[model samples]
Target: MIDNQLGIRKPRGLTAALSILTTYTPGGGRVPYEDEVGSDGLLRYKFQGNPQHYTNAGLRAAFREGVPLIWFFGIQQGVYLPFFPVWIVGVEAEQSQVAVALDEAQRSLPIGGVSSEIERRYSLGITRRRLHQPVFRQRVIQAYESACAMCRLRHRSLLDAAHIIPDRDTRGVPAIANGVSLCKIHHAAYDENILGIRPDYVVEVRADILREIDGPMLKHGLQELHHHALALPRRRADQPDPVLLEERYDRFRTAS
Candidate 1:
């Protein structure tokens, strides 16, 4: 019964079908809103001013020991409503705590739990196609032997499997034909439309970048790649699809 004094408002009908996972208490008052989540999937909550308070330390330990923590949101009508409980799994320090929601099946799937509830409404073929993404990067990286298609950078840690058409697009399939292994720098440039790849696999720097007399990173890392063909996969079928490349290249061209 710690007066954390913050609350998370759940959307209407969010707990309607997932009631089994949610916990409710009547007149629980307001809960704190200071939950900070990171890209690495660690959600942190600091126990206000006295972060090392006994209660905070105890709860942090429980969370790290896999204890389920009920996230209370305040009372609605005569009942205290809370969202689905999350399993506390990590404690970076006595004051900082981390936890993940209890949705094993959904969490294990790709794309941050697109929610089977929502995805069930889509066609089976679409769902099945999207599900293959967990293995998509592996297949693409293997095809390129973990090298960047643009600069032939061989550092696996700095490489990414990029999509010709964004993964969110309806036409973007999780097949090797729609993927290219690129280094982190190239991926960012591609995403920002500062760099583009033609349908014929030739690289192109945005017109503005080509004109800018910048440093070595800009000149050699980007401009030098202009008109150079992407280092394609050894297997012809693993090469990026020309149609998808054309579609994406059009967007990059428009941005440039």
Candidate 2:
């Protein structure tokens, strides 16, 4: 933290003394002490090595005053997902760690720690999705250059990261390879099985839908995409997993 510029940041000359911002980069180069949010939906932010350090004092003050801070989670170089208003709920001197909560509900939890694995998971399942979706969307959207895989719609507001295998599935993960960038319409359609993407990168409209009479959106936006090749990321690592794509395609086939 001393040498590396990113970590807990405390604004100088503040009245109550506060660490206003912090940053986390998943799998980015190592840090002396890592700040992590586990499946329990609690973030453990380790203070500076010295408990009496100014930064540590600032963090403690933030907790004491019930103040919130920004957590900038790095997605790529110069790209970050900013999670704001995260509260410092507790400070553990033994570990020199502060308990950070991403939302109000999390702030209300037993910040010392939630012991039972099942209970912790149950409480945080929804919270996990809240954290997962934004990061997943950013990563997937960037991978596809912010365009729909089928239609190539370039509007950032209209785009979404559709999971190839859903978050509920055991095989699903927030990894870029498990997501496909699509516009809102196509995302909903993919989720509803109105359309599917084959492992070979082909887009397919449901047979029944293709046979139906509908508006221009049905014709130009969807039907026209049938048999068309899926738009893929240039980076080989970011390309959709063929196995996951096939698995979802099977469900779409059955639904068809």
Candidate 3:
């Protein structure tokens, strides 16, 4: 990991070089970066490029074993602010290897008392991953037939399995009944209280949003979505829990 405390700055283009959110780059190769993996399975990333030409072999070993590694982001500058997990999917060359993981797993980390540098970083990373586990998200996505529950947008990239009760809540669990697939736009609107989903699976726009006479984004995106029934999962077992949705909707209504 590059530590900014020692006055060491990260080299350019490093952030674009690694990602866990997508497996393959547009060029169809793995992400390019140099990091060392100890026998204990911890990854120590120091730079963006593998100047020693050992990255290919190391990544190959990781991919072959399905090993997960913690990627440490640069501190102090606030670029790539949080540490997250990554899997080496493919190793194209000494300088090119593909890595992928979920960005959601990197967000909303809780800060607390630290026993050591290692414990502080690793504990939060593990907690964040559990909050947005891939298995939970995939179950909700498949239950919705890979379409937005609100707008029915079928594009997988734009879709997200949003929580009816946010993970910050004590009752929020990574269950299909606590989630809904929504496009990125609608998800943001829902989180901001511009839109709300009722317990009966009906969607509503906030009264203020309904009164706005704006452009296509507002008209089609938020205003026109009032009172639309959510596109539900086929299996009743996978559907959003009415009790949870009602509780969340009550919060939305109060916020509006």
Enumerate clash totals for all models, in the order shown. 7, 0, 6
Q: lDDT of candidate 3 vs native?
A: 0.59
lDDT ranking, high to low: 2, 1, 3
Q: Which wins on TM-score, candidate 1 or candidate 3?
A: 3
Worst 10 residues of 1 by lDDT: 16-25
List the pairs of residues colliding in candidate 1. Answer: 6-31, 6-32, 7-31, 25-80, 26-79, 26-80, 63-88
- Residue runs of model 2 more than 4 Å from their true location after superposition: 1-4, 14-36, 46-57, 92-96, 112-126
Query: 55-93, model 1: which lDDT tens digit per residue?
Result: 555555554455445554332222333434544454556
Candidate 3 per-residue lDDT over residues 1-256, each given as its tens digit:
4333422223343322222211111111222221222222232233225533333344455556655544543211243333345654434343343433323332222222313566445543454464234545655777788899888899988888898898667577666788899999998888899999999889999998888787999998788889998898777767888999999999999998
TM-score of 3: 0.55
Evaluate residue 102 in candidate 3 and report its C-alpha lDDT on the 0 to 100 scale: 25
Model 3 bad stretches (over 4 Å): 1-124
Q: Which 10 successive residues of model 2 have the least lDDT summed?
A: 26-35
lDDT of 2: 0.75
List lDDT for all candidates, in order: 0.60, 0.75, 0.59
Q: What would you estimate as the lDDT of candidate 1?
A: 0.60
- Candidate 2 residue pairs in backbone clash: none
Per-candidate RMSD, Å: 18.3, 4.1, 13.7
